[model samples]
Target: MSVTAQCPRPESRALRENHPVMGADWGPFNVIDTAKQDWARGWAALKKFTEREAHARVPYEHKEGAYPLGQWVAEQRRAYGAGQLAGLRARRLEKLGMVWSLADERFQKNLEAAKAYYDQHWTLCAPRTETALDKPVRQWLSNLRRPGALDDHPEWKTAPEAVDKDWNPSWPADWQRHYAALRERVRDEDGPADVLPGFTVHGMDSCRS
Candidate 1:
């Protein structure tokens, strides 16, 4: 329901180049891409839980392969939220946080499954396991580069626009745009029959693998 933290993400090439220590300061990222109307309400009410890891074969990007959007989302929600309970201190979020990390040791297994599921030979979606090079620098960046920032980080030198200026409370502009796109409710181009000729809707994840 309410996401107050961000699961660590691998730095984009743009980010890493601009801010070498890009981890500590980015802030909470609670958005998950889903079309389920009950997501927010469901998340706000459910207890944290996990199931056995699963996989499937599917076609993607003009080719056929296997996908782990299933397992990846599981880890994305379950494993990432294991630490949320303490912060929220509310039984509801705590309940939603789960007893502990699910798929705890299945990172490698799930990643392989997701990577192979896509039709193309893609590898960029893997989870981030690396540590930032400098904690203080990263933290400064997260606070919108408050004080004692790197004098010449690429961001400050060539791209001042990359600096954070808005400080209200809602999602940043770019992310807001992204969420707007995802949260929009629009009719399918025609209908499922017109588009998905042979696809399977796998629970929340509709795919044919």
Candidate 2:
């Protein structure tokens, strides 16, 4: 009777531990995919906002649903400024008419308001307390007159000038207001109107020399 030697079978095992190969880990890939998805979602929300508002100058506190779209826009501007934004992403934002600088956008918006005020009143000498299109027209004008306000953006000065050549007159705003009132009265009378001293038109003493 040959006794068969019961040999314990060697345990089946890998030649090495299951260590991930270099650059083959899915952890980094998953993180990148998640970031890309988040970005795409933000882009979609911004596209909708631009389509409805006709602009991408979203307020910093604004949001779309639960998404902080305005914050995303600000991030994009920061990234672009730092040269970290991908070219394709920048182009996509530009196509949506994104305004990278809120300051510049505000200036343009105020300029439009100034133009509208001029169209209705025929002058840009609005009172300091006056508002046009919900904008502080006089205050904005006052800011524009500050030294070096337009040094870096000289082209902006031309827009107000085109709206009204005397928008930034050398004369005082009060004087211009009185003069405009007097001129309107003269035109209505179709000749020289007898505007006596202390007489007021639209709250302005137009007859005052």
Per-residue lDDT tens digits for candidate 1, residues 1-209, read 88798665664645644563553343234244663444443442232222221222111221112333334334435534675324443343344333333333232233333334221211111122311222232222234334544353433332222222221124443343232222221234444333233432212112221
Give Cα distance to truth, residue 48, candidate 1, Å: 11
TM-score of each: 0.15, 0.66
For residues 1-209, what per-residue lDDT tens digits would candidate 2 score against the true structure? 79888753444212122335533553453345778898899899999999999988888899988899989999999998888996898889999998877778888899999988887677888887788899999999988888888999876878888887877788887888788777776786866577788877777787875
- For candidate 1, list the clashing residue pairs, or say none: 25-142, 57-209, 58-209, 66-117, 67-117
Separately for all candidates shown, the number of backbone clashes (residues 3 or more apart, or on different chains) is 5, 0
Evaluated with lDDT, which candidate comes out highest? 2
lDDT, model 2, position 165: 81
| RMSD (Å) of each candidate, 1 decimal | 31.5, 7.8
How well does candidate 1 match the true structure, expressed as C-alpha RMSD? 31.5
lDDT of 1 at 25: 44
Candidate 1 vs. true structure, TM-score: 0.15
The global C-alpha lDDT for each of the candidates, from Candidate 1 onward, is 0.32, 0.82
